[model samples]
Target: MLQMDPMRPLDPALPITPQLTQRLRDRIIRNHLKPGDRISETEIAKVYDVSRQPVREAFIKLADQGLLLIRPQRRTVVSRIAYQDVLDARFLREAIEADIVRLLAKTRDDALIGTLRAQIELQKRVHADDLETFTQLDEQFHRMLADAVGKAGTWSFVEGVKAQMDRVRFLSLFDYPMALLIEQHTQIVDAVEARDLDRAEENARQHLRLMLDYLPGVIAANPSFFDLPEGGLAPSVNTPTLGGEYT
Candidate 1:
């Protein structure tokens, strides 16, 4: 029952493993590969007319990102989102971005404000149903702030740690208010432009904390997609029923 959209032929000239890794990551994040769905290295290899070696490499990379579960002598499956992982990622993001906005406010960069304003306009133009495009724009908006402060590498590190958070976000995109999100983006930009460091930092922190407010509802609506206990905490990793056993 696993269905994937048609993928373009792998470029013969470029390295294959990273390409496969990114493509497979996209499929996983977009829900094309649901949690607990079994996947075959051989099938994916054949899909791109490649050998299994690169496919295996891609699987291992994704497993490291907590997006894929690789079991020895068994099928590889998409991982259910770990509640702790999402919380930890949001914590890290808020810590970094809140400071980034405050720094921007201190500097009061006109060009940066202009760039963010343009980005906000682009976000508003995305149709409400076009969650994928809005998500991309949202990332771009944040990355622009980081880039303004020479923290692009830091942003990359955050990106590496946020796969689980991104999965939950993609799930909630349909119902989450895109307009409110855009407003938050505007608030941060406005605070920075006004050179109010305290207000900018607070706005950034509040914006990032929206995930905490939204996560419980997302989990309630899609209980099967997460690995959470009755108390709403992440279960120990060694839990046999959800961990060792592959359903």
Candidate 2:
């Protein structure tokens, strides 16, 4: 069983229900609550020193997110990560990101390009010693790029899907080379600065491809983290066919 710190702080401003819901969601994404694990609202309330009413409300929110399944008779379990869902989410993300790059190339925003360059430099420095900070900045860099194209809302949708893949990403961080990621970001920035749409798209595609390539190894090492079919493992969300064309 995965153990979690009971004393973790809740978002003080949020209603107790949403606070609990977000906490549970975080636990699930962080791999502290594995798929198909049974979760009891009563137990959670007790653990968090909260009332059952709040826990019940939280569970409902989680169920709506597809992170939890509420069965008949008040039982709830963490939903298994569906392979098709992952594929669909990745497909949408790739399409949106490709569009982002095309828009960015046309705009040629020097200020935004400079910000991205600074982010890449920070990514290199922190990645060597502190992966946690590097991960946060890495996410910011991508978001910043999308924002530059006036697609922050689109990127938020992308992020919702990406959240489902966080566990796999966390696992890959242990084995994958961070230097390669930095280099990929740098190349994309260079292409954008040159106002080369085709080259920027190719670079972005390559960066996502690297992530797709790493999925197999991640699943191999942490089989329990994935939702594999009975007969064989499923392909990752970032399959070549899905991301090949801009939609």
Candidate 3:
């Protein structure tokens, strides 16, 4: 663990606050900072060779984003990833993505279609070796479709939710076949290109549903990663529901 002093000054060259915030956020997302693990501000300040003020500020930002929990006079820890929160995030993503597909189907924007095709080609190129690159292209493919339909805002909202779920997806990749993801994305692109609105929507839904189905296995594999009430990673009897409107 890195340490930092609250009284020291940050480097003159760096944008201390945002840089630290992103680094900490990445650490949390990558499970380097596990759920319930304590974060020491002074330690962070030392690690980054900066003052405690920026570290404290970064902690507050992370807390506001539901990524950290701050306790007065006690240790601050990475927030537990809640089942309800995961479900809600998934629902939001599905709603927005489904809508984006529907609108693209209706509009049939050639430019967007071309971009999607190019993205698919890129995916094929990198799918064999780089999962991170493939994942980024997958995100861009969907965002391109949304942008084509003038629904980029919806994509942005969906992106925020997706980011929350990415850790689970990353874990799932350890157990699931990447080929399946590639195939699914291919099917979605085919449906969209064919102008089959219903098929496209169903494909998108199935993609999300597959992810939801894999959550149990992910939790089981990484019991310590989730912040469940009892039995930690065991499935809950009252499965949380996720769905809502977004402007």
Per-model TM values vs. the true structure: 0.90, 0.84, 0.81
Model 3 TM-score relative to the real fold: 0.81
Worst 10 residues of 2 by lDDT: 238-247
Better of 1 and 3 by TM-score: 1
Clash numbers, per candidate: 0, 0, 8
Alpha-carbon local distance difference test for all models: 0.86, 0.75, 0.73
**What does candidate 3's lDDT look like per residue over 1-247, in tens digits?**
5433334444568789988887787767766677888888888876777789988999998887788899989889888777667777777777677777877777776776777777777777874656667767777777787788888887766755554587676666556566777688778778878899878877787676677678887878777777666645444222222232221
lDDT tens digits, residue span 50-92, model 2:
8888988888877766678899696788886655555566666
Query: RMSD to native for every prediction?
Result: 7.4, 3.2, 5.2
Which sections of candidate 3 miss by over 4 Å? 3-15, 127-129, 229-247
Q: How accurate is candidate 2 locally (lDDT)?
A: 0.75
Ranking by lDDT: 1, 2, 3
| Alpha-carbon shift of residue 117 in model 3 (angstroms) | 1.7
| Model 2 / residue 226 / CA error / Å | 2.6
Residue-wise C-alpha lDDT for candidate 1, range 153-178, written one tens digit per residue: 99999999998989999988887889
